[model samples]
Target: MSEPTAPQVPAIPTARRQALRQHLMNEVTRPARRPQRMLVLAPAAAVLAVVVAAGVIAQPWAPRSAPLIVPVHQGEHVGAPLLLNQMAVAAADTPPPGEGEYVYIRSRVAVAELGDGPARLGPAYEREIWIPRYERGDGLLRQPFLELPVIGVIPDRTTLPDMPPNAEVVDLPGDPDELLAKLHRERDERGRGSSRDGAAFTAIGDLLRESLLPPPTSATLYRAAARIAGVEVVRGVTDAAGRRGIAVARTEQGRRDEWIFDERTFEYLGERSYLVADTADGPAGTVLATAAVLRRAVVPERGQRP
Candidate 1:
């Protein structure tokens, strides 16, 4: 009180006062840590983008049912009908040209060139067939039961065996309903005959599944390959007059096989088995069987007469 010296100021601690001022300055001047400067939103954005990308990679190019209906079975459609119409069976005692298996049936047969075409008939080199010598009641050819008509289109050199003038050609007995009525009628009327044997190239070609084929045979495969390649069937078999079936197909493997059927019925006619070579006239394969063992028969006309 006395001296009023330096007007006594309230006691202030220098260190405390300095610290309080510094704290205030820091709170006012620093930039709030810039919201932690963190790019956390960037990571969330990246996660969302990744999710969108995953959904776009899972689908097919086309519908699904468009691949199976393209290849139609036109080959059989074209040839089978004609084949059924003209097909017939013939017989063989010994082998025909190659290796024939059949030995004895009811009818008899001999190799005779009914026609003089250039094409080789059946699977064997020597062309032969299973014709009928009997006749039925199908009406008469040219004359009224005067001459026994030929059972097959092709012909054979038969002893004519005192044939009843009109007997069915039993070369291929496998046929069922094919030429039966005609055969019986011909035999009954003329004693023997040859009616359904000769077939033109268009006809045979119509039946041929192209030409040379691959192994693992099946009608389906043959028709497919044949249509794809534009191949042709045997042409110009000597028109000398021999009724027989054709070994219509060949394998790249050399297998050559044909079937001879009964004109009356579509029986499992005689079969020709042999092989072909890229070159050479000699048979590269062999003939397996003939009229000796005919399969069942085939009937085409449906409920036609006998």
Candidate 2:
């Protein structure tokens, strides 16, 4: 019998490829908020062939099996504004990534999974990503396989195309008030969250997570977050890696999302989300997710470390 040949796949255009990369990255990096219908990534066979040939499997969006729930440690609400000001000063002191370098971030994250039974959080997993300083350069993402099977084989690495910068992170004005207004407008247009204030807070955290922002821009983000209503301070909170820090948080609907910072230095540490009121997903004070940033630095290449 003759050997079978591989199917030919058409080359994806630059614009389309960029859009695909953005969609995949957003799905991979963002935390799942609630139990919802999963959107299966079943593109045309030709596109799927190209993606698989590039050593990247579209992550399955199936409902995850419930794991153990982490307990939430509550704290008082005072000095949130003052703490944000201190964080803004610290963020401004950090230098931005140089041109032609990659921003490397190593983190430990445990995301909550909700099934038919109850909501639970999975074990913490280490995730590393290399983002190019320029939008034209390729990037890399490395993490262990989840419990669920992906295409019947486990994948530990994914090669990502050059992703365009987020407009809110890259183009917003430095003035805090103007920046906040723009975020609110964009959030409303996208219809992201239940309230405008909650959407703005989530947007700021998303910008901080995987992207490297300019020093002034980072400072502006913290200042803008401070302006959002319902922001409060939570003390003595621990991240996924068990690092203790203070947090600035906001409660919307039934969940509270917190951005943790070093108590003394006011440096960014990580973030966590938990329930404040009992719901069908889980009980009050049930932790939904937790993440801790272990290291961040500028590297010369995609796979290089500091």
Candidate 3:
């Protein structure tokens, strides 16, 4: 009786309190019918804005997936990658020709002939080729032992009549993919029925043999060859000049083509071809052709020997 008693109120349980709070929140957040139109219009506007942004984002400079063409991996042959890398290094280390000079190359060549009866080995002869420093100049070819003219005449072979105009050594692409694509395009244009990849490899071999390229360009050629499929490691190959080395080879329909390199020095020694199957040119296992480079230098004149 000392103080006026106030009415007692029961405390709500945890569950009831949570439910009341949720109910209040829902009631406060509930949209009025009058505002529903605005809510619907706002979502539509937002969607339209998103679509417009998407269209703007679709640009040519946008990030894209990587190319589908996979690079060649080091496979069962462990030495393949190492050999190719070594060649690339050696190529980079090599020197290029000076201005107003000719590139001189000395080599030995041997070919086999398949007659109506059987295959016969042809004579192995020493040959020298001289190419001008310029892109579209004539080149000289001669055999000194045969007592040819002092000023060697430019041979028709050095002109690469079979290849396209742009397939010249100086015009070849420095990038691997571009080189390959060019090769394919040329083959198609020439109406060649051979395997495009195999033809590409052969074309690379021709470029390496018949011309003198800059160090960077030579390295690019080696890297490009490594990317081609069907190339394999051939151990214990001896070139025509009796230089022993490892080889990178490929077996096509009837021939096994090899590009030999010094095992330790990684210098390109030579290239050869052997019959894998009986063909009109030779029988199986016959050596179709062999070439070993003996010297390479820059000279003052086309016929001048280095």
User: Which candidate number has the best TM-score?
Assistant: 2
Q: Could you give candidate 2's per-residue lDDT for residues 1-306 as a string of tens digits?
A: 995332223456667666665554444533211112111112111111112224223223323554444455564555777778878899889866566467788988766544333555655778787775654446677787632222232356766564442322355578999877876776566564357777677767766665667888888888988888889998888888888988898888878888888899877788888788888757887776778889977777888878
Least well predicted 10-residue stretch by lDDT in candidate 1 = 140-149
**lDDT per residue as tens, model 3, 1-306:** 494322222355667555644433222121111121111111111111111121111111112322111112222345565667678989899876665467777877654432223333445667776665644456555652321111112232332212211113445567877877776776676565457767677767765664567788788878877777787788777777878887887777766778888888777788877766666544566665577889977788767876
State each model's CA lDDT, in order: 0.23, 0.64, 0.55
Task: Tell me the deviation in Å of residue 54 in model 3.
Answer: 65
- Which of the two, 1 or 3, has more TM-score? 3
Misplaced by over 4 Å in model 2 are: 1-26, 29-78, 95-100, 147-154, 165-168
TM-score sort, best first: 2, 3, 1
TM-score for each model = 0.20, 0.74, 0.64
Which residue pairs show collisions in model 3? none
Q: Each candidate: RMSD to true structure? A: 42.8, 9.8, 34.6
Residue lDDT tens for model 1, 1-306: 573222122333667545534432222121111112110111111111101111121011112121111111112224543443333211111122222221112211111111111112222122111212232222111101111111111122221112111122122123233223332343344332222221111112212211111121122223332332222233211111244432233222333324333334333333332335432212333221222222112122212111
Model 1 residue 255 lDDT score: 34
Residue 162, model 2: lDDT of 47
